[model samples]
Target chain A: MAFRASVVRLNRAIVYTQNGDPAQVLRALTYKPLPPPAPETVNIKYLLAPINPSDVNVVQGVYPAKPSLTSLVDGQPDVFVGGNEGLAEVTHVGSGVTDLVKGDWVVMTKAQAGTWSSSRNVGVLDVLKLPRVEGLTEVHGATMTVNPPSAYNMLNDYVALEKDEWVVQNGANSAVGQAVIQIAASRGFKTLNLVRKRSDIDELTRKLKDLGATEVLTYDDLNDRNLTQRIVKEWTGGKGIRLGLNCVSGPDTTSMARLLGQDAYLVSYGAMSKQPLALPTGLFIFKNLTSVGFWQSRWYKQKTRSDKENLFKTLATLIGHGKASPEHEIVTIPAEDSDEVAGQKVREIFAKIAEGQYGKKVLLKIAGSE
Target chain B: MAFRASVVRLNRAIVYTQNGDPAQVLRALTYKPLPPPAPETVNIKYLLAPINPSDVNVVQGVYPAKPSLTSLVDGQPDVFVGGNEGLAEVTHVGSGVTDLVKGDWVVMTKAQAGTWSSSRNVGVLDVLKLPRVEGLTEVHGATMTVNPPSAYNMLNDYVALEKDEWVVQNGANSAVGQAVIQIAASRGFKTLNLVRKRSDIDELTRKLKDLGATEVLTYDDLNDRNLTQRIVKEWTGGKGIRLGLNCVSGPDTTSMARLLGQDAYLVSYGAMSKQPLALPTGLFIFKNLTSVGFWQSRWYKQKTRSDKENLFKTLATLIGHGKASPEHEIVTIPAEDSDEVAGQKVREIFAKIAEGQYGKKVLLKIAGSE
Candidate 1:
């Protein structure tokens, strides 16, 4: 059965032929046919995918999940899938399939289902039926599963942010941070957002404020020795901040740690700088600060079906009512070339993400125009 | 006013005078008169004092709290008091004293009260009335406040341990660890205790077991690579350990982090090894582990008086009934000591503690036979 599909046939990928340099690698490929889905799998017609930091980490071989190599034409497996999550429409259900039907929009709910392909078969348990929101595009739905859920879970699970309480999160302009700002604001909680100083600082601050941030400050502002003390005085009326969410680690974490009130929690979901978290002993001992880490994928796996359902319902309602929406930059790729060109495009987008250039999510539009 | 007291008037205490050398600082001191109690104070005659690891830490200048250097004579402090807590007899009441009367035995409830004194003035709030326990001597009553209260609060403040559930703690032979074992045992919860290997490993294991430890293993035994896997298999019945209490950091903490189940908490109260805790990212992300640091003094200050009173009552009952007792090595020091000499003795004792040489607490006996 020769079906049209984009393929990385052999031992070749946008190779980084050199170390410690970004310019050495460009997209190139050898050739192979796609493997058929297993008995309990369903074939998905790729709809949309997003380029995330984890994808970049995988390309650089620094991620925890590594791709296995297989021999191609020259007994060398040079091709591997690159994306972690994406939205897809079920095209064919295998013999053992019971729940999913054709035309259903689904999201990869577990590890190992790469969504960069045009058509790929995955185990039924690995995919979740995404709740339909009217007028919600595949691009928005694709990027929704990871960051929005991360923001939602961290806020709900760790500490219940009361209507009057405040939440402070770094990377305010990133997808997750933006979701946090919107969700918190809609729930009647205030947000103290932090972001790096960009050329359009005023505009960026205004945009975040419009999205529900009470106060927005640049990283440079936090460098002041008395910044923590000042922020606490102004925002909390001398009560001190209760919850701090950090994706950027390093000495910045130390500053965040100092700002938290007694018995407060700081949850770090990502280490963008790849630096060790050097926290002071005084904060932990004197203030009773709790430094915790959060990974959305792991958290989702541990949650019960009812919990996931509740989250889906809440998030879907928010999206349906236009209370929260992801800011995404969508790049359309023909469905026929999704597998080969989409992965390379994702790697390129991820490079920009790693450089901290993108203001919103960089998405791949896998399906043809509706 | 000539008050009979044993005093070290000069800089000659159990002086090690050398690093890595044995404790050769035990010495006698002359007698001196103490000043009269202030208007808002009560004069207490020393009854009993316990030597704690923190006291040892203080003596070595490694403790967070440093005594003020105001009582010095000539170039050095002449007479000083050195003991964190002890049972004392109220010998005289100050002019404004209303709640306390002479002949009542009281315990110094505050952190700074030096109990190794024949007669010293302390505020009413700094003392607690000691209940009459038939076999509870001044020695046993003297050491009651800190450890038992610490253990009680740490266990209760975090996750409430249910019957048949497991609680794990390192440094099982320490005062706090023993208290946890006994308290948990009484509550019908099992404990997995860890300890460093000693000459009397078997005997120590037996003693801890007798004190309510379900399983006691030396550090070497726990250092196994598969120790966490084995612990999960045996203790949790493959469910995973719930609560972890850490006093020793470094790799010991790393082990505890690995053994915990999802959403489990690892609360560290002490750093006996003086090494920073190194936690792996996997534990933080996959296991949903929370790392928290605890300081008893901070917690005590933060808690309400009623809470403290309840904890004290429960602890007093436990001590009175002989259900909980801290092991100690008594070292009699004169009540009257020159500030420099007394401080020097404390420093020496604390240095030995930091070296991990002393298996038992070094106590100070004042105004009485050793």
Candidate 2:
């Protein structure tokens, strides 16, 4: 038998050599492809990746976890890969790998695994093989790991919120907030969503309601204390707001906190408003409220592999039942693009994010599986 | 046997007919004596009562729980009693009473049972008879139910701090703070006490150290980041400050909250600053810290009779070992004086409290027990 022939393919990646503005600090490189996977390793073809706000922060070097910079990729400056969340297909697998095979779909398990590349080789444990559902799209699977899990854990983990119990959340238009609404509705829990007022308030409210939000209100509605009290009284049946999810801090945080019942928990996952959480002293003393932080990344680090898989399966079942779906738009990236062209495209997308031009999650489609 | 024919002795109590400043709203009144104890009732002769801040708030009608206004006390306006905590001796028991005789010592178990009186007729269940200890002075026993139990529960209930672990607290000079320092020391837990800067910083530090405080620093010392970090590192041996007791709020709250390790709890029992607790957003988000409130009165309502006795016994054991004692000054109220003269004396003591002239706890010695 003749020996197998080897073929060389050029791999391109977006990276940053130093932390700064993404437009100024990020670059693209075309380099030699990975050699054959060693034992316990797999080579993957990048499919779909989401350009999350946190990904931008990672490029700016402001994120808590940073990607590893390396000199392994020749003809390029030592750089760290730019994205944290993405979908990939295993194209090759080493002999010792037992959990995955060629053609299996996977996503990066460990954060900062450099998913911004067209293709890469990683340890089998570095990626989690996802269970395929008949109608599960790559966009849903690509973005599912972060925001959906965050919302899911926040709802189930904190207080023992029974059926029909109410949860309140601000930033209700964000991806995580929308997922919380749908998931809570699926679990027989009601959600009170607070969104910032805008020209399209009516449109946004309708959109969130369509996603199964129990009630949607503007920040102005929160100031109408009598109205808020009436609504809460009627909706919760005097049980009081049990759980609060705060991403937009400042006075908004205090308002939501005030609405909570005795011993209620306010789990904050993000502070998008750049404002500090101003909690009133009386709330802490009189209401006996508890304010805490939740980081899905930290939780991920603590959970076992089967634990994660079970959670993913639970999410998949919800999606399969048509109870949950992420609103998103895909921006396709050419697989054979030049270094400069790809870097330019990445910058433009980030600029749009900064400008708040995109209302839904913007995902990157590289190998075109979506 | 001679029945000891009944004598009508006048009962005097401090009362509040309206809610406002303590000086203007409170009054002293002499009223009709108890006819006799009904079955399941007992008559208690008051010994000592401590003036707590909550008592003042209750009289002002600002507190959540309020005492019932009534015409039960003859010759007095429709009003409520002026105190919440005190030590008393059982003077008479009803036919159904099995737990006590005339000499058993007890304290009010329910709040707003009109404790600040020379004597009271109540259901036997309204007071909990304490197990007498040889050296358990009226001063310690009268004050034990509030500050000591508060410090005890806040230490043991919230966090499972192991030996050699650390707790940080502001208001180290307050009654609860002093109790915490002593109790934690007895349990082999170290404390980092934060007090306000004063002209006698050295003297106050020495006094706290004498009470088994691991380290005592002024609020200015908290601002000295290097010194604070070094002290925490050395005292905790890197376990980090796991529990924080906050009474004084405002900026001091944020500083103490910042000192805690990951997933630690800051329990706010009082806001002595009268300013709201101002917590930074990052502490909640990054450190996973929790801010909550502790109300001993509420906790008392939830606990069983045995639960309270166990805690009291634990505290008495500590006190018996000279491990804990409340820093206090005794103010005598003449037992044989007329109502008007006793009222004048009560007003004088309250004036001293308002003027901040007394540094330690002020206990009313109505019966000269201590």
Candidate 3:
């Protein structure tokens, strides 16, 4: 590789002028070169960015956290940049950027910095440098901060799991759910995974097992009391499922609650079902089971810089060893494409995601100029 | 009042051999006087016993804590006692009974000791002596352990409500709800109470206000967004509702949850609606609210003897100062009536209770032969 000149370059960004459906409100804009990073800041060229459910919610104006829109970008006044999670390459460093260098790779530690762009400037404090370990793909680094940490923290934060202890979760095939199984397996904890019934039930079960799930069942299986009893008996030898991760609420939440052991906790993170959580009164009154909500964004806000960097270092090591990695589908956006063409392509993918046409997460790869 | 003979008395006992409807399974039996108090026991003449909702649940075999049905009573074979709360006068004390005397007033501290009888013997450990306060009544002593402690602990245990801080509770006219209002008021804590609509709404509101309620509203008020916002603002003065006491689950719980402040807690102790608790995803995700169950019986089981006595002492002081008292209705059960006649009357009152015929709690006064 030749040494690339540290020169100014035109920036391309995806911006949303108002809160509405992404296809209707989102636009692509070309702007003047981003300013050389401030003394305490570092310039970065985004390598890849993934579309998250929360990111979609932010664009639609339903999420609580929002990016501040101002007349910061030249030519496009009062516009907000689009994405929250992505991987980037350090293109230039400011005078005060001590820890990061031109060749280093980084990912956002905090959210709402607008990563859906070809190039941007961010304070060194906003990004955590990823270790340059072999086999650590840009796809893995792009997606690591949100889903993996959520799974790792949910499993280890509330309850301590001894080897062979059980952890149960609904939405077992979701991105975070897959990460939970693999992480728990690596830690010697067993998982009882629940998923919605699909036509490819056997294939899905096999795939989850390959990812380290100890057992798999559908929502229909949860209703069969005798089957649940038999599974609990054989899987735990009568010990209770100590930690329950609930992302799908409604009757799904109540069914998962029934399988909790004494003093167990069911942490609710996402409500993909858009249904309210229903819990039997006896569960809380007699069994002492607790229902709590978890938001990775909130947890991210509270964590310290060193804490976040340490988590990333650990996750990177896992990815290096192939012990923790999310399944993803990559979509490459060409560097020379017009703003309108790029934005249209992005909107099409968002529409497919809304219709559940894609099972794996979709990542947008920005083909940088060499 | 005449000085009655403190002599051996024929004891009439009410017992149930199996769990079923209180009216169908309960029977009265005239038995020999309970054996003279054992070395560590005291013989007591029952003064008053109140029928509680949990008491009904106990008789119907739906409660978690069940009295062991053994052939303990002389002629009644393998039967469980019919009551759980009462006030009594110490008629006799055994040689080893050091703390209690012949006329001391006491009440059952631990649950499931037969309380619905004319006379009985119990170990001193089973009862906590009521303070000899001038204003203390049999009704207050009979119902101290469950509701008052439940209200006090729920407000104090989960979250700390400082002076002038606000606490909200549904079922504001129920025994526990009324107790919560009085206790919170005595501590300088403000309360926003929610109750069901009734024909006598204003009358019930006035009654709760007399018990120190800051404000009272019907369930309909919860549905009006502007009304809820205005009440929350005025009651809290922008401070959050830190503690929410919920006894009625279902939509009642969801409505209460909506009014909680940031990081607030909703403690569910009873489900009068018999409906499951339903909570919206946003409340948990954004407000950081939590839902937990509270069972006074469970708390009582965990507390030490001094812990129980100290609580009762504090409660007695409150009652003596006219700060705490539960509303009650008293019924006299004549000691000389036939087993058939007395059982018939007991069944009639229970039927009334089942029909929600009375607002005040019913207390049976066994007029033992003098």
Candidate 4:
């Protein structure tokens, strides 16, 4: 089988023939590599791809975005390569492409654009050229495309939050949450963060504070209404929080939302609790609260290419300036590993991500071991 | 005591010196009438004021907007007059008043402006002169300031609903609900209304249907998702409702919101259920559902006087052309009613409104009987 694959130089991609438990359905498949890019296309070598929580849901067939089925993996009639976000290095540029060339680093502009493959032929339109960055790490580049921009856009999109205005958010230990803390702090805004209570609560609070959080509390802190009220009084001086970011829903989100003032907005991007968001109807009517949502994928789909480029440029500049940096972990698949071993590793990492037990965002480095 | 009270031909105004149940805290107090209106003011005789549910909450001191404390009732050091909306006649215009003359119909321009009074000394800024609306009844004129405009604005505010597009709403038998049906029908939009199941379901459904609801559903219908699916398929050709008007929340509204399509909005104007709003977090993230609020009092506070006058004119025109008429019942306080009798009547009507047992809006005719 290896000798047959070598006829065109084989490529390995994470594949799922059907949707279900990622462990049962996902595998690494070897297939003949792309012959060459057609005009206005490029062959991209995926350097790193992050295992986002939403990506796990996609594999489970529970997410709204469905991955496009591809027949390029191991001659399968139907296969879906996983991963929505990653950074890539252009290996070959097809004729008629002017902007990107070999050795240029870029990111995928399409939603669920199958980024888990070691290498693939991609159209120029599907790739976004990245601005040069100083001291950029592989982890930041791979994960920045989703979480950092998600935080940045959410901070700017809903409310023109003013200086000294603080944002309240739950799931403050997530990658996006850290980015929110850093970005908000750099913009002169304060962040009130919430994470689940854990045995290592003090350590997590210290880490979040190091990321620029003004205050880091736990879901357990919500029970003390007086404590939250004091935050409003001592921190905000009677002015309430104007924006709230939610990922973990249910009682935690409900409690976080209470800190919002009149005409405030609560933007939801994830449902980590797997439970629904609930709030008092009086909040909407009396406080004039607005509950909305943000999906980075949707933003990518709607925004112009330049708009997306600008977003990345902004985030990169912030990173270079040391104002913000995404916190993540890299899980590399050794080059000598067999397809079965690689696939098993992918499933294990994803399970950890789905359970949210992994300390930081986990990015898959499939190109080879460092 | 009666002879002494006639010293200035005493005027009666609602007085709630402390906050509690309307029955316990509210009273009609006869105090010395104002000598005259100050400059740029008028002595207006309140013709009619409706007992709104929020007013009951206001008397109970539960609503966000606080009634201004005044000492004009029974010489009380602190008193809050009961109504938020009503129609009045300019009985005696102040010296500097030019736009308003004797007998010109007007509505209060200020929120919680002590509308539940037989007569009050008010500045011209506190009142808005009415447009000459032909065939306008006291019910439509008195009640139009809050509910009709609420329905009208709510219908137009959130979504730019196209013709044939459907709007879903709970509390379909409410005064605002009827107005929503009529206004939407006039504008070529469709309405899917929800009300609680009642012994007279057919009668209520027929009434709302006559007001131009495309379909009238009860909270019970929400149990059968298939029935709602059928409505989407058969009635709307699979296009889901884009706007949901929620006055009741909790599970009933959660089900109602499920009928909404992607990128839909749920605007809450009232909380009749006295419960919190709750929904699946996935809806906000996946479907991009937005939950906001509509408070007519807030709208009135922000909009320019002409902007407000235009809204009233639009509704008045609709009423004049037989496009709509506010559904209301008159509870007249006879000219000879003692303060005790009048106060008791107001409390009784408010109790019914609070319980949602009143068939139609109850407009208090306090100036005199026919």
Model 2 alpha-carbon miss at residue A101, Å: 3.6
Please give, for residues A1-370, the per-residue lDDT of candidate 2 as tens digits: 1112155566777778889888677777776777789999998877778888888888887777888886647575687878889888888888899999788889877888787777788988888887788777787788878888899999988899999889999999888898899899999998999998899988988888888898898877888899878866887776689899988888877777767888788999888778778777777777778888888888888899998988988986776565456768888777566678877888888888888898778887653111
Error of 4 at A94 (Å): 1.5
Q: lDDT per residue, candidate 3, A165-236, as tens digits? A: 989999999998988998898899999999999899999999999899999989888999998787668777
After TM-score superposition, what is the CA distance of residue B361 in candidate 4 from its true location, in Å? Answer: 2.8
Show where candidate 3 strays beyond 4 Å: A1-3, A70-72, A95-98, A232-239, A367-370, B1-6, B36-41, B91-102, B233-240, B367-370
**Over 4 Å off in model 2, which ranges?**
A1-7, A69-71, A74-78, A323-327, A355-357, A366-370, B1-8, B35-41, B69-71, B74-78, B95-101, B229-239, B323-327, B366-370
Error of 4 at B44 (Å): 1.2
Q: Per model, how much of the real contact set is kept?
A: 0.37, 0.68, 0.62, 0.84
Could you tell me which residue pairs clash in candidate 3?
Answer: none
Q: What is the TM-score of each candidate against the true structure?
A: 0.66, 0.91, 0.93, 0.93
Query: Residue by residue across A184-295, what tens digits does model 4's lDDT show?
Result: 9899999999999899998988888887899888888888999879887888887789999999888888888768887899999988898888998888987889999898
- Cα lDDT tens digits, model 2, B79-198, are 788888988888888989998888787877788777777777888877888768877888887887888888899999989999978889999988898899899998999898999988
Give the alpha carbon lDDT tens digit for every residue of B63-178 in model 4: 88888888784544878888989998877777989989887889887889888887788889878887768888776778878888889999988899998899999988888888
Pick the winner on TM-score between candidates 1 and 2: 2
Instruction: Give the interface RMSD of each candidate.
Output: 2.7, 1.4, 0.9, 0.9
Order of all candidates by DockQ, from best down to worst? 4, 3, 2, 1
Q: For model 1, how does the per-residue alpha-carbon lDDT over A66-99 read when each residue is reduced to its tens digit?
A: 5443233355444455467788888667777887
- Arrange candidates by TM-score, descending: 3, 4, 2, 1
Please state the CAPRI-style docking class of candidate 4.
medium
